[model samples]
Target: MPYKARVYVTLRASVLDPAGTAVQKAIQEQMNVEIQSVRIGKFIEIFLDSPDQTKAHQTIQQICEQFLANPVIEDFCFELDEIPRVSNLASQG
Candidate 1:
């Protein structure tokens, strides 16, 4: 079976995001609104085939830990969706 996975990577709360802070500063300067803070992140989605949900999840987590997300200054979350089987007969009929 195939599964769809979504990974969300974001800067840790304690980390300083220079880009986000600059954007917020620009907005505050132009709009004259007091902005507390701003943060930026990345989102990634992938599809994979696996026989078991547990294995799929583990694989996705490994991907995140190894390449998708930076563990030192960032945090991540993931969601998995099971792919529904498609039937050729249903399409033909």
Candidate 2:
């Protein structure tokens, strides 16, 4: 079976995000809304083939911790789902 995983990486609350601050300023100026703050993050989607759900979960965790996210400043999380194969007839109908 094949699986799709979505990973989200976000900067820690203590870390400052200049880009996000800039966007917040722009929004406040343009919309005249009293927005307190804004934070930016990254989203990543990965598709892989794995039969063992347990192993897949562990692998995703490692990937996020080791490569996808920066432990020093960023935090990460992921969601995994199995892809359901569609038959030809299902598509035609």
Candidate 3:
């Protein structure tokens, strides 16, 4: 089975986001509404083939913890879903 993973990485709440603040100010200037705060984050996608979902889960956890997200100042979360294999490649096209 093929799995698609969606990862979301964001900075911790205690950390200051200068880029998000700048974006908020920009939005406030263009619009006539009061904006309190804005925070920027990252969205990543990973697709892989695996027979064991548990192993895939552990692999994804390791990937996120070791390579993707920073454990100190950033937090991350992900969702994994199985994608059906396409058997007919030239069915319509």
Candidate 4:
């Protein structure tokens, strides 16, 4: 079966986010609403096929830890879903 993984990479809480702070200030001024804080992050989507769900989970974890996120400053998490197999309805016609 095939799986789709959604990954989110974020700066560690102790790390400062200048970009996010700038955006927050801009938004507060433009909208005239009080805003406490904002943090910037990355969103990544990956599609892969594996023999089983367990393998898919492991692969996604390795990919995130090794390639997608930086361990020292960035933290990462992922959500996995099995891609549904749908029949070709048009071909049936």
On TM-score, the candidate that comes out on top is 4
lDDT of 4 by residue, 14-77 (tens): 9999999999999999999999999999999999999999999999999999999999999999
TM-score, every prediction? 0.86, 0.90, 0.90, 0.94
Of the pair 3 and 4, which is ahead by TM-score? 4
What's the lDDT for residue 73 in model 3?
Answer: 89
- For model 4, the run of ten residues with the poorest summed lDDT: 84-93
lDDT of 3 by residue, 1-93 (tens): 899999999999999999999999999999967999999989999998888788889889999999989989899999998887777866866
Candidate 4 TM-score versus the reference: 0.94
**TM-score order of candidates, top first:** 4, 2, 3, 1
Best by lDDT, which number? 4
Single out the weakest 10-residue window by summed lDDT for candidate 3: 84-93
The best-first sequence of candidates by lDDT reads 4, 1, 2, 3
Model 2 TM-score, all chains together: 0.90
lDDT of 2 by residue, 1-93 (tens): 788999999999999999999999999999999999999999999998887778889889999998999999999999999888778998899
Give lDDT for model 3.
0.92
lDDT, candidate 4, residue 93?
Answer: 75
Any runs in candidate 2 off by more than 4 Å, and if so which?
88-93
lDDT, residue 12, model 4:
99
What local lDDT does model 3 show for residue 63?
A: 94
Alpha-carbon shift of residue 84 in model 1 (angstroms): 0.8
